[model samples]
Structure formats: structure tokens, C-alpha cells
Target chain A: MSILLHDDTRVIVQGITGKIGSVQTKWMLQYGTKIVGGVTPGKGGQVVEGLPVFNYVEDAVKETGANASVFFVPAAFVLDAFFETIDAGIDFIVIVPEHIPVHDVMKMRDYADEKGITALGPTTPGILVPGKGKMGIMPASLFAPGRVGIISRSGTLSYEFAGILSEKQIGQSTVVGMGADPVVLCNLPKILAMFENDPDTDAVIIVGEVGGEQEEKAAEFIAGHMKKPVAAYIAGRFSPQGKKMGHAGAIVRGSAGTYEGKTGALREAGVTVLESPIHVHAWAEKYRLR
Target chain B: MRLHEYEGMDIFEKFGIPVPERGVAGTVDETLNIAEKTGYPAILKSQVLVGGRGLAGGIRPVQTPEECRTTAEALLETEIKGLPVREIMVCKKAVIERELYLGITIDGYSGRPVVVVSTEGGVHIEETARTSPDKIASFKIDPKFGFYPYQAVALLRRAGLDGKPLNACADILVRLYKVFRQYEAMIAEINPLAVLADGGLMAVDAVLEIDDSAMFRVKKMLSLSPEGRIGNRLERKGKEIGVTYVDLDGDIGLISSGAGLGMASMDIIGHGMEPANFLETGGGITADLLYKCMDLILMKPLRAVFINIYGGINPIHEGAKGIVRYIKDHGVTLPIVAKALGNHQEETWEILKSGGIHVVTEAATEKAVERLAALLNTSSPMSRS
Candidate 1:
């Protein structure tokens, strides 16, 4: 009953031969993700963590019926890998690398849109469906099966929130790290729509940060469409303007991407916006979301 | 990665987009030489990265060699927004019949490159876009097919351009699109694409910001303006080590695993206590690399250091080891507050405690910040030997 990923969502790892890919593949496997195969150019027929490797995604797709992909490819090769995955008819993809060229990200996002595929991130930790399946690099111990669907723009912050939720015995349904890139494929609104429809998700937690209008737009969508209770925690409230605070997307340009703007919008949307990550548990308890 | 006007014009010239003959000058002699070459009625533009150069009087239209000398001297001495004017761009002033705007930038919402054209040009485009949105015409370019001629023509025509101006604007737009694509630019703008009195089109002002991530692909373009790499010593050192470190006006040295986490840490360290710098060690960094990052953060005068790590790809133990090694080797006596979560958290806690470091066990950053603030309030500032 997860939002994007489930137990039978057969996944394949792209760039599985690389150091990060191999490590994450093992971690994803350990988290009970149904990793079917892997793809690494010139490394076909190789085995990584007992999964078969193919030179191309098409081969992996054809042989294993892998409908999802997790790209651990370098930033330079992300576009090519993305195109290949799209062409192979993979429905979902998680791009793990950060600092992907904005142009390439745009193209990948546009192509993914045209093809109707769910491409997650260029700098994301991917998605986690607690006690079921995980497709990202998030620590598995921090999650538990619950009714709250969590969506965030950060990996570490997602882990932090999940840890808080786990500590409070407030489990989650699915957690999606939309990546902190300025141009991400699955924005807050799109993921919110999915969360709104999921019956297993009684409430949703949005971990938003400064920069970009995604949070504002998400608030707009929630105000109009959302029926379930939602809580939010935004980072970078005290971050200085103009200076990019690590994330490519987390910059306060003029008044467009400020914490106040985002928080105001979310509060107006009937969402309980928490002042800190630890307060999410208390807020969730107050809301009485089972 | 934002190119100066002179550098932007260089790229425009390479793409055959019409630009007024221009030369960059660092000295009064160089300014005089370029002024002579470009002839009288030249424009002296200070080449600083920040905007509002025109409002700051960094741009001066000089009529004579004497005026050029005085203006260039004054501009070179001036500082716009705290950034000194290191160089001035001297160019032949174009006769403007009409000023138009043409720019290619990524639309954050659509996740696509967009070409924005406006007949109401030269003034604050942001203001125009905010207030009079209908004054400008925007065309989203599909990156797969790129900016087509028909799309450019349609946008230009919609912006009240017709006949010669329309075709000329279309040509420049296409050429600008090429430059945008070729250089992998985040923003390629000709704020005032001036149409001269004689129906000639020229880029009066140019701004091109290349995507910093695409630097590896455009080494030659970067090498052309190596001196443009402007930052402090810590930033430069961070760049060298494949990390991001931005100096701030605070006393608490901070380090975190992810960019979002780093920024969130900075935000949580509230109550008038600013973070000294923003440091993201990134994922899967080794203990040695973390030690180097600690060394950079420790270089600054700090009352306390807050190390927050939520290990996903980056193991908490590695960060703990790095901090332990740094403390043991450097004998850093500054009051330090650390919070480690995720993989190997127990071991990481044990290592830091064994190294005689007090670790903040609060999982929430807000509580951790409160703990750090309380610790700092109780202990006097350490005297650096």
C-alpha cells in the first residue's frame, strides 16, 4: 500500500559496477528491495550481490521484467542512462548522483514527462516504503511501517524525520526524497497527489526547505485537493539570502524562495507546520492520525 | 560560474551574435588603449559579478580619452556591493533605436529551458515579469528538440517585433540558443538587444552563467577566464578538495553530511549565534577526507564546533573517527557539540566519548542547538594559542 514503491515493484540498478552502485545495491537488497538485475556497460554477465548484470537496460528489462531502475551513474552519464531507461520502458527511476548539469536534468525531466515515467531525482536518496521495499540509500533502521506518507527535498533530513517518527512509534507508509536539485522530476505537488489517494496513508509529512516554489505550489495543491491531515517542517529559516546553502535549489533569491513565503503558504493551506523536526511526533499525536 | 559581461560578449561573438566591439581592461593604460581602438563615445563597464552595476555607476559612457581615463580610474577604485571593480569592459557605444530583451533560462516549475522575449527591455525585467507579466513573451523549449526557428519567430512576433526586426531578432535568438546549449549555460541573457538607428541588431549587454556542474565538459571555456574563480581561501580549498565550504559571520564551526542537512543545521543554530561556515562532507566520504574537512572548519576562529551527521551513504562511524583523529592530532580544546545518527550510531557515540568528546544525544537538531547554545553560554570562549 506504498505510494510509489511496493514489495513486487521489481527494480534494477544502473551503473552497478561503480563503488556507490555496488554498495547501495547491497543495502537496498538488505532492505528487502526486489532488485532483479543490474546494468553496467561492458560488464554484462557479471554478478553483483547474486543479481545478474547486463550491458544495457533493455536486456535487463527484457530478461527480468524489471519495471524500475535506480541510477547510480555519474553526473556526466546520467542523461544517457536516463534516456536508455526511458527507452527501455522503465516506469520509475531514481537518480542518485548530485551536481547533474541543470540542462541535462531539464532534458531528462522533459523526456520523462513526455514518456509518462516517474523519474525521482538527480541528487536524491530515492524512495523508501517502510517494512516493505526501499529503492534509495536511506538508512533502513530509521523507518517503520505506519500510515504517514513522508515527502522531502532532502535525504539526511528525511532520515532525521524518520528517526523522530520511529522514536515516537509513529510509523510511515512511504518516504520519498525528491532531491534538492532546483529541477526535480517528481515535485511536491505530484507526490502529494499520490499521497492523497493512498488509503494506507492517513496523514502526510512534508519536509520542505528554502528555495524554489515547489513548497508553495504544494501548499496550493493541498489547499484545493487534500482531505487528509498534513504536517510540514521547513529547513533553512535562518539561512542568508543569495548564498546557495549547499543544495543547488536551496537559495533565497529575492523574495521568491524564502522560508516565510513557504511557511505562510503551508499554514494558510490548513497544514500544521512544525517549528522543528522533533515536534512532528507531538503534532501527529495531537492530530490523532492512526 | 556567471560570466562577466565581457566574457558573455566573447561567447556571443563566437556564436556570431552581433556585439559591439569590446575589450577588457584592468588598468587605465589598458582602458585608454581599448578606448582608442573602439573610438570615441565608448562605454566603460566595471566587470564585477553582482548585478545593479548600472545603478551603482559602474558603467560610464565616455566621450573623450580624458573622460575615459577619469571614469576608468574612478570605476576601478569603486566597489559595487562590496566586490571591488577589478576590470572594466570598454566597448563602442551602439546607437539604440529600440532595446529588446532575449534570454534563455531554465524554468524551475516546468523543468525545461525557456526563451523569454520582451520588447519592453533594458529596465528591471524581474519587476516587469512580476507586475506586467503580459509585457513579456515566454516560450518553453523542449530540450530534446531544442529551440526551433519557428518557436523563436513566434515568440519574437508576439513581442511586437515585425518585418526586419522580427527576422533579425529570430536570428539572434537562435544564435543565443546555440551559445546557451554549446556552453551548457544556466542563463544566457542579452538584457538590451539594441536595434541600432540603421536597423542593425547588436547585443548591448550580455550575461551568461554556465552550469557549475558542467565545468568538466567545458574546460576550454573555463580556462579562458581562470581569474574569474573568485572566493575566499577556505572556499578555494573546499573547491580543491571536492567539498563545498562557505564562510559565514558566525563563531560556531559547523559540518554536516548533506547540503540540506548542513543548511538545516545552520538554521537550527539560532538565537543570535551564527555558524562560522557551511560545510557539507557529501556521501561516502572517508575518515581521512572528513579529517581534512574538519581541518578547514577548524582554521576559522570558533567558540564551538557542531558536527551533525545523518549517515546514509556516509557512515556515522567514519565521521566520528575523523573527529576523534582531528581532536587527538590537533589537540583542539574548543567546546564541541556533535550529534550523529544512522548507521553505526552506537559505535560512533562510543568513539567520540572515548576520545573525551561530549556528544549531544538529541536526535532533533533544534534540541541539539539548544544544548550547544547552553554549553557555549556556560563555558568561556577559548583563547587560541
Candidate 2:
């Protein structure tokens, strides 16, 4: 009923021996995700959290039929790990590393596109299908099964939005964090298209920020092709010019990436853009009433 | 990180891209010595990161040693666009037949590295791309195949470059792409890829911006300027401890989780008091790191401190522990407002209260900002307890 992930999605954890990978694997397992196996390059033929470990993704896939992958590799090794995953035919991937070099991201995006694989992020918090399956590092307690599909560029903002929706008794069908990088693989348009096809998803909430033209492109897509109700909240409205506000991608360069431009574009596309993150509940309610 | 023009040129020179003979001078004597070796008609350009240096009189052409010395002296003493010139690059001016632009940048729209070239060059390529889009020709480089020799030639040819100039320009474009990839650069630009009267091409100006996150891999490139730190002292200290902090012109010191939330918190401030700083303690930040972040932000002269956190990977408990430890250690009496949600929210709030610190329980940023405004107004005249 959700987009990208479901109950039958057998996931494999890459870099499973790393501290973050181990911890998140436990969390995902506790949430009832079908973690079939793990892959740590050096530490093969081992057991981590009751799952078999292999050296390469291909080995893990051949042994366990692992079709999905969640990478916890460091930024330096993300490129190599990404190529391996793509080569192994893991159609679904969620990269958890941040600060990956832009050149590597370009290559990864290109290779993923050519091979018809779904790559989530090089700096993302991962994706979640409420009460079905979870991949990546999102805290599962804040989300509940609902009809609203959430997509965000910020990890913590995604958690905050999900928390707000959960508090208002509104839940999400799926929530995807597109990472905080300037160039991400699964952008708003791609995820918007998926949400449009999910039958359980009644409305979509897009959490975007200043910097990059992804939001404007999403606005254009929604204007022309979408049949689902969409509401968005673009952050960094009062951010100072030329200062990089934490995220490497969250910057305003000239007139290209600005809050005013993104908000105006979304509003013109007949989408209700909120001024605050907590207002997603109100929009969801409006959609529900309609 | 944006490299100074001289530094970028040094990389270009290393990669076999032709550039004018140049030397950096910090004094009048140094300028004269460089001018003597570079010959008369030397160009004195100020070394500053910001643009519009040409319009700000940061650049001057000196034909005599006396003019060079005086120009260097003036530039060294002068501030162009609020950035004082600490060094001036003296180079032999080129006999230009035409000016063309060549640059390689990651196109955000396409998610690919694009090579942009224009026959009409050096007068702001962004403006040229906006006004007459046809004047600029761009080719998105496929990362798997890279910028091939044929692709570079085709790109230059499309820009109306032909014959010897086209070959020379194409060679420079290929080398520039090498420099871009080798150094992990975000932008490798030569504004005026000057074509000499003898039909020779040289990069008269260079701009290279490397990815800051790639600093771990590109050590030698960063070592070119060991003291070239990006921000003020507070901001630099924040960087050392994994926190991103930017000082602002306000009195309320603010710390938040995500960059978007940090900005949203600043925007939500209702009172006249502006945010003194923007600090983001990234995901999985430890208590010790959070304590360090609080210590750094508290160092600034502020009316109050607001801590807004929405934890995902960074648990709320760690942030709470950091705040409590800071309050207990410093015995700070300044009005502190905190709002935490997600992962261990209840326990985090309880810990903050136990440490005798008032926590803002509102989930909305505006409500928290309102609470801080109310606290600041009511506590302005009250003595520290």
C-alpha cells in the first residue's frame, strides 16, 4: 500500500559491522522489517543480530534473495559501495552517508538511472512505510499508518512533520527523506509520481527548503501531471544570503535558489504551501474533508 | 572552499593549463620586485574572495615601477567591497585579441557536471546566460565517460571557436576538466580565457572552488593556504567541534537540529531581539559535543539562549544532558528556553526540569519563540538568581 517499500521487501544491510549500521539494523529489526542478511567487506561469514553476513552484496543477494539495500558506509567508501550495490542488482538502495563528493553523486545518479535502480540518497535519513517496513535511520516511534504520504529534504524536519501528524491522529502512508544534499537521487518529482500511484495515499506533504531547483521542478510537475492533493512547506525563508545554513546544499546562490522563488512557484501550481512545519496536519485535515 | 585567484592559478599551472606568470605580493617592495621580473605593464589585482573586485578599483595596470609600488601600496591599504586586500597578485598583462569564457560546474538542474563556454567572455557569464542564452553553449559531462577530447572540441566548436583558437581552447577545456576532477572542485572557471594576438590562448583569470567536505581527501590542496579559514573565530570554533555556527546581528543565541529548523526558529522570533547566532548540531551529536556547542554559543553577549531540537538520529536525551550539564557547570542565570521532540522526548524534558532549567514544551516553533519573547520581556529587569 506504500511507495518503494512494503511487507515483502527483503532488505540487506551494507556496512553492517559499522557502529551506525549495527544500531540502525537493530532498530529496523525491532520494527519488524524483513532484514534478510548483511554485508561487510572484510567481515564475511559472520552473524550480526541473528542475520547471516557476507563479504559482497552479490554474495548476500545470491544467498538470501535480498532485493533491497541500506548502506551505512562512510562518505569515502560510498562510491565503491554504491557501484557494488548497483552491480549486484539491488533495485532499492538507501545511502546514509553525508558529505559525499558531488562528482561521486553525479556518477552514482547516472549509473542508477541507466540501470533502472532506485537510489535514495548520499546524505539521506532513509525511507519508511508506516507499520509495514522501514529502511534507513528514521525513528519509527514518531510515525503511524495513515493516508498522507510525506517527502522531505531535511531528516529532522521529516521526523518533526511525522510527529506532528501522529499527534494530530493523522498518519503517513510513506515518508521519504531525500537527503540534505544539493543533488539527491530521488527528488520531489520522482517521489511525487510514486505517491500519486499509491492507492492508500490520500494526499502528499512535501517538506523542502531553499537552495537547488528541485522544489520548482516539483511545482512544475504537480502543475502539469499530478491528480493528488499536495501541500508543501519551504524552509529558510529568513535565512541570510551567501551564508551556508548547516546543510551543504542549503544555500542561496544569486537569484537561482531562494525561498521566495520556491514558494511562489509552488503556490502558483495550485499547491498550498505552509509557513510552518506543524501546519501539515491542517492541510491533511482539509484534504480529508474534501 | 573558494580558493584565491593565485591559488587556483597555481593548480591550473600544475595541470598544464597556460596562465600568466604571476606572484603574490604583500608589500610595496615585493610588488616592485615581481614587477621587475614580470616586466612593465604588470597587472596588480587584489586578493579577496568576494566578487566585483574590478569595479571596486581592486585591479590596476601599472607600467612603471613607481606606479606599481604606489598601486600596491594603495591596494594593500584599501578595502574593496569591505574585504581588505592583504595581498595583491602581480602578473604580466596579456596582449588580448579576444576574451572568451570557459567554466565547469555541477548543474543543479541536471545533477551533472556541465562545461559552459561562451565566445562573449569576461563580463559576467551569469548575465550572458540570462540575456542571450544562445551566446553560451553548455555540455553536461557524463561522469562515467567524463569530458572526452571530442566532446570538448564539439563544445568549443559550437561556441563559434574554430581553427587554431578552437584547438587551443578545447585543449584548455580538457585540462580545466582535469583540474576540476582532480581537486574535487565544485567550480573551475576561467572568466577570460584570453586569446592572444598571436592566436594563443591563456587563462588570464581563474576561479576554483573545491568541495569543503572533500577536505579529508584533498589535504594538499587545502594546505596551500593553512590560515584561510572561512568564518570568524566563533564560527571556526564551532567547525572544530562538528557544529555549524554563523554569528548574526542579534541578542538571542539559538541552537537547533536541522539547518531548516535553525532558520525557521530564527524567523519565528517575535520580539525585537534578533537571533545572535545560527548553530546546528547535526545528527547523532553526542552530549559532550552538544555541551561544547552550548558553551560556544553562550560565549556571545546575548539576552537569552533558545535551544530548539527535533531529534531523529540525534536523540533528545543527549541534547538535554548537554544543556543540563552546561547550566549546572556555568550556573548561568540568563533566560534559557528549550523545546525538544522525537526520540526520548519525555525523558529529555524531565531531565531539563530536574536540572532547574525551564523547558518550552510547545511542539510549534512559533509558540516556542513566543515563550522566549515573553521570558525575555519579563526577565529583562530581574536580577540573576
Candidate 3:
């Protein structure tokens, strides 16, 4: 009943020999993510977290039947890594690199969409089904296997909220990082629809920021189709216009992507919108207590 | 990155789009010389990135060389929107019979490129879309396919525009699409695509904003970033150090790891204290970056500092070390409260505690912000804006 990642979603790590890649791989392996092998162009024979490393994604796929991938490659090489994963016929791709050029990301996303592959982020924390499997850089300590599905555009805020929900004995079915890039592959609506269909997810919480209209679009999808009770906590309500707030996609433009704009839309769609991150526990408490 | 009018013209010419005859000048003498060749009644526009140039008197009509020289001098001396004008664009002002709008932008909701067109121009398109929704029309570009003239032409026709003129506009759009794609522009617009009395199209004004994330690949944009572009000093400093810092008219300084958490922290802090600036490091926090961020917020005399960070991908230990180093190096006496957790939470808290930082261990950020507000209330006021 989980979305994106499933029991059979065998994964491979790209740029596994890199420092961040190796460390995160160790953490992911520790969390019991079904990681099969690794990929590093030059360091093919090297091992990371006891996983066999290969130069090409195809080789790893051929050997392990890996259907998913987590990219830990640098920004300069992300496009190539993205194409490699897509070519390898990977169903789900999680991009960890944050600074891939906007134009490069556009082409990468376009190609991914063309291939019908679900790609996560250029600057994403990755997705977690909690206790099932984890991907990307989201710390596993905060996540617990539960009933609510959480979708967010931020990596840290999701963890911050996840910890809050977990503290209240409210676990999550799955938490998806919608990525931080402006031209990210998935949006809130797409992920929201998937969460609605998942039997394990009874309620969903959308963690949105002020920059883009991901929240607004999801509001439309929720107001019409979603039957499950939804709660949302949006960030950047006080963010200044034109300031890139940590995330490339989270910028307050002229009369657009405002926190009020997003929150208002979500509220109109009949969702419980939290006042601040501090109120997250209360929001989840009400949902769980119900 | 919003390109200046001169830089926009260079892009327009590079894309083979039709624009009026123009030349740039950095000095008064250069302005007179360019105006002399362009003939009398040329437009002198102070090349500042801020809008409202026409109303702000940044744009002036000069009939004589003396007027041109004087206008250029005053423009170069004065500041538009508090930004000192570094360059002036001298150009032949063409006659405008009518105004039209054309733009290529990323549709945030759909996450795709969109070509927007309207006969109603020379005004804010958003305003037009709000007041007269039928005046403006937009066609969302497919993410998979290339934006061709035929598509723009079809879109224009569907938007109630017709005739040979649309083909011309469509041609310009195709070229503009090249500029939009190649430069990785978030927005490339020609507001007031002036229709001459003779029925030819000329881009009256160009607004080309390259995506800041893609600026690294566009090598030419490297030097001009935050150069006379950002009016705020601390904001410019933040950009230089690769951190997201927004100066506000408030008191408490803020530092957070993620934008969502940063803004959430702002909301909690704003309940009791005014946030002086919004600062977030994303996943790119280093000791030096954090040190510079602390220095940046400290530039304005603040009441207290509230730092809410979580170490996920970002190294909280290294970032905490930077904060400790900054506090010790400057011998800071301000009330600094930091709520740090995840990955290296213990080491981060230890380092902050050593620097006299009020550290909050629990994940809830209210604890840190609440402690800071209590501390600030007790501390003496440092009057600043």
C-alpha cells in the first residue's frame, strides 16, 4: 500500500565512492534500505557500505535487477547520471545533488518525463516508507512506520515535522520529499493522488514552502478528488520577495508563491493548516486521536 | 539575475530579435557621443535593474548633446531605488502605435515552459490578467518537445491574434525561446512589443532574468551577480558567501538549515520578536559559510540571534564549529540561541555551549526561540532598523 517505493524496489547508489555517497550509503544500509550495488565511473571495483560498486548503472541493474536509484553525484555530473539511470530503465530515481544547472535540470526532467520514470529531486532529501526502506539523505531517526502520508518540498523541515509527529506516537505511512529545485520532476498534486490510493495512508500532511504553487495545485486536487482528511504546514510565510530561501524553487515572486497564497488555497480545500512547526504535534494529535 | 537594459539588448541582438538602435555609456562624454550618432531626440535611460524607470525619471528624452550629457551625468550620480546607476543606455526611441506583450516563463504549477502573449501590453501583465482575463493568453509548452514558431503562431491565433503580424511575433518568440533556453532564464519578456505606424514589431523593452541556479553555466553572468543589482549590503554579502540571507526591517537575527524550517522559525520568533533577517544555508553549509552568515546578520546591530538547524545532509558539527569560531573571534556579547539536532546534534550542542550560545536540545524550535525572546526581553535594547 506504500507509494513509490515498495517491497521489491531494489535500489542502486550512483556516485557511491564519493564521500557523502559513502557516508549516506552506510546510513541507508543501516536503516535496512534494499540497496543492492553502487556505481562510480572510475572507482568501479571499490566497495561502499559492503555493496559491490560498478562503473555503469546497467551493469548493476543486470546483476541485481535494481529498479530504483539514488544519485549522490556532483552537480556537474548529475545530468549524465540521470540519463544513465533512465537508460538503465530504473523506475524510480532520487537525485541528491542540489546545484545542477537549471537548464540541465529542465532537460533531465523532460527526459525523465518522456521515459515515464519517477524522478525525485535535484536537491531532495529523498523518500521514505519508514521501517520499509529509505533513500537519499533523510535521517531515519525521525521517521517511524505509521498511518499518515507526508509530502514536502524541504528536506530538513520534513524531518523536523516527522520528529514532531513521531514524538506524539503518530507514525507515517510514507514521506516523500518533492525536491527543492524549481523544475523538480514531481509536484504535490501527483504525490497527493498516489497517497490517496494507498490503503496504508489514512491522512496526509503537506509540508510546503512559499516559493512555488505546488501547494495550490495540490489544493485543487484535494478539494475535488481526495476523500482522506489532509493537514498541511507551509513554510516561508514571512519570506521576503525574490529571496531564494535555501531552496532554488522557494522564491516569493510578484503576487505569487506567497505563504498566504499557498496557505489560503490549502485552507479553502478543507485541510487543517498548522500555524507553525510547533503546532505540528497538535495537528497530528487531533488526526491520530480521531 | 535581472539583466540590465543594455545586457538585454545584447541578448536580443544575439538571438536575432529586432530591437531599436542602441548603445551603452558609462560616462557623460560617452553618452553625448552615442547620442550624436543616433541623432537628436534619443532616449537616455539609466541602466539600473530596478523597474519604474519611466516614473522614476531614470528615462529622459534628450534633444541636444548638452541635454544628453547633463541627463547621463545626473543619472550616473543619482541612485534609482537606492541602487547607483553604473551604466546608461542611449537609444533611438521608436514611435509606438500600439503595444503587445510576449514572454516565455516557467509555469510553476505545471513545471513546464510557457509562452504568454497578449495584445494588451505596456502595463503589468499580471494586472491585466487580473482585471481583464481575456486580454492575456498563455500556452503551456510541453516539457518533452521543443518550442517552435508554429506552436507560438498557433497559440497566438488561439489567443485571438491573427494575420502576418503574428508570424513576425511568433518568429521573435522562437528567437526569444532560444535566449530563454540557452541562458536558462526564469523569465524572458518583451513588454510592449511596439507596433510601429508602419506595422512592424520592435521590442520596446526587454526583461531577461536568468535563473540564478543556472548562472554558473552562463559564464557572462558570473561577474555581474549582486554587482549594483542588490540594494541591500547584507544580502549582497550573503549571495557572495553562497547563503540565502534576506534583510528585513526587524531586530532578531535568524539562521536556519532549510527554507521551510527557516520560515517556520521566523513565524515562531515573530510571535515575540522581530526577525531582522532571514538566513538559511540549505545543504551547502560550511564553517566559513556559517561564519560569514553570522557576520552578515551581525552587520546590523541586532537584539539577539536565533539559529534553528538540523544536520541531515548538512554537517551540523562543522556549522556549529563555525558559529563557535565566529563568536570567539568577534568576542560576541549578544544573546545567541541555537536549536540544533540530527546527525551530529551532540557535538553541535557542545560547541555552541562552549561559545556561550543558549542551546536547545529538543526538536521543537519553540524552545530555542522562546529562550531567545526571554533573553532579549531581559537584555538592553539595541536601537536599529
Q: Which portions of model 1 miss their true places by more than 4 Å?
A: A243-256, B161-164, B378-385
B12-107 in candidate 1: lDDT tens per residue?
A: 988899999889898999999999999889999889887667877888899999999998889988887667788999988888988888888776
Model 2, A182-270: lDDT tens per residue?
A: 67876779889999988988889898888788899899999998988889988787777763211112211335578888888999999
Runs off by more than 4 Å, candidate 3: A243-256, B220-227, B378-385
> Over the stretch A44-63, how does candidate 1's per-residue lDDT look in tens digits?
99999999999999999999
Better of 1 and 2 by lDDT: 1
Question: Can you give the DockQ of every candidate in the order shown?
Answer: 0.46, 0.42, 0.42
Per candidate, native contacts kept equal 0.51, 0.41, 0.44
Best by DockQ: 1
Candidate 2: tens digits of C-alpha lDDT, residues B1-385: 7788899898899999999998998789998999899988899999887666776788899989888877888888987655568888999888999888888877776788778888888755557666776677788887767777788889887878778788778888999999889898888888788999998889988888888878788866554754533566787798889888887888888989878778767666623558888998877577888789889988878898888887566777977888889889988888888888766878999988877766876556666666777876642211111
In candidate 3, what fraction of native interface contacts survive? Answer: 0.44
lDDT, model 3: 0.81
Query: Which ten residues in a row are the worst by lDDT in model 2 chain B?
Result: B376-385
Give the count of colliding residue pairs in each prediction: 0, 0, 0
